[model samples]
Target: MTTHLTGSRDEWLAARIELLKAEKELTRLNDDLARRRRQLPWVRIDKEFRFETDEGSASLADLFRGRSQLLVYHFMFGPDYKAGCPSCSAIADGFNGIAVHLANHDVSLTAVSRAPLAKLQAYRQRMGWTFPWASSSDSSFSFDFNVSFTEQQQREGSIEYNFAREPAFEWRSGKEGDGASARASFAAMTGTDMQTYTRDRPGMSAFAIEDGVVYHTYSTYSRGVDGIWSMYPWLDRAPKGRNEPSGPWWRRHDEYGRG
Candidate 1:
């Protein structure tokens, strides 16, 4: 009763073997790209950026936590959002498990958001995540990274994200196609208006601290983050690889049965 292609044992094995060869090639190419990523030059961070965390106020350097390398997952939990973005939350669900191994491997992994420390703490408790989550509420950290935008920017269509300047997302007279519906749905989930919901963006930034100077090594956004998504790769091997037609077919790991 299968709806997909069916084949005899020998034919299936032959196809699988061919796929395995391509998979190995992709793996090698990924390894090469990773090496190139590490080779990207570093930009020194000179501004005095501060954040509020469970450990109290800390500087950008403090985020490194004695490790030379630091990785920050830019979580989308704006100051006005009642809850975190479902998509960002889904990505963050895997953070706790990786934090331990990364800490031991000379890297500190942290999640940074524009939400207040109190809100972040509350949400972290709700999600049962023990990894360090910090607030950039009192700082321009998110703005400097271009993951957070302002009302004027949204109105003027001057939003910059994913390393490109694009029209800001405004629900009223803007947004097109599935992007609009996805924004509306996520906005409702966060208990905020569409404009406010789109104020923050999701991304990852990597830094390296050498001789007490923090350097911005590399940053990735949009689909570049798919590697860390943790599930998409597995789904790619499934019978229907992420067969989402209109919008995202995912939710926060904690919210799977509301319907």
Candidate 2:
């Protein structure tokens, strides 16, 4: 009844041993990449960026919270949305548990969104999340970081993200399983249209402080953030390896099993 390959124990062990060699090589390569990321030149942040946090108005340096390292997850929750993006929410589900560990390691982890503080606070409470979240509602912090875009930029096909210019409207009509419909579905779940929903994208930025000066250290967007998705690493080691034929079957943790 099954068409999957079957092999003797010896054969399977031989194949697994070969795969282990490749995995070790990949692990070494990843280590080198991490080292390179740390060695990259840091860009000084001279412009002032502000945020609304539970503690009231805060500046970029304040985000470090006495730690030298600051990591901000650019959560996708634009002002127009009634809720946060499901994908961003999924990624954030892992944040609360990791925040304490990171803080102990001298890294402050926070989520930044373009939504107002009230909306973010309500949603954070609903999700039962304790991780620090800040609103960039009254600041150009999101735009400066290239995670939020303007209407004019979208109209003129000038939206640049992930170190590349995104096409204006082509992705909207892309075939199913290519992420177009999935994005639209996520937008609807967030009580927004695709355009408004996509105006804000997901990213994470790393910053460092030295001598009272703040500097941008690194950033990653789109698929580059896969390493931190929490579930994907486990899924990758599963028998079926992500197992999705229909693209993104995940929902916000609370939304699961309701349908």
In terms of TM-score, how similar is model 2 to the real structure?
A: 0.96
Model 1 lDDT on a 0 to 1 scale: 0.88
lDDT agreement with native, every candidate: 0.88, 0.90
Among residues 3 or more apart in sequence or in different chains, the pairs in candidate 1 whose N, CA or C atoms overlap within 3 Å are none
The number of the candidate with the highest lDDT is 2
In terms of lDDT, the poorest run of 10 residues in model 2 is 169-178
Clashes per candidate, residues 3 or more apart or on different chains: 0, 0
TM-score of each: 0.94, 0.96
lDDT of 1 by residue, 29-135 (tens): 99999999989989999999999999899999999999999999999899999999988898888888999999999999999999999999999999999999999
lDDT of 2 by residue, 90-190 (tens): 89999989999999999999999999999999999999999999999999999999999988888889988888886784332233244777778888999
In model 2, the clashing pairs are: none
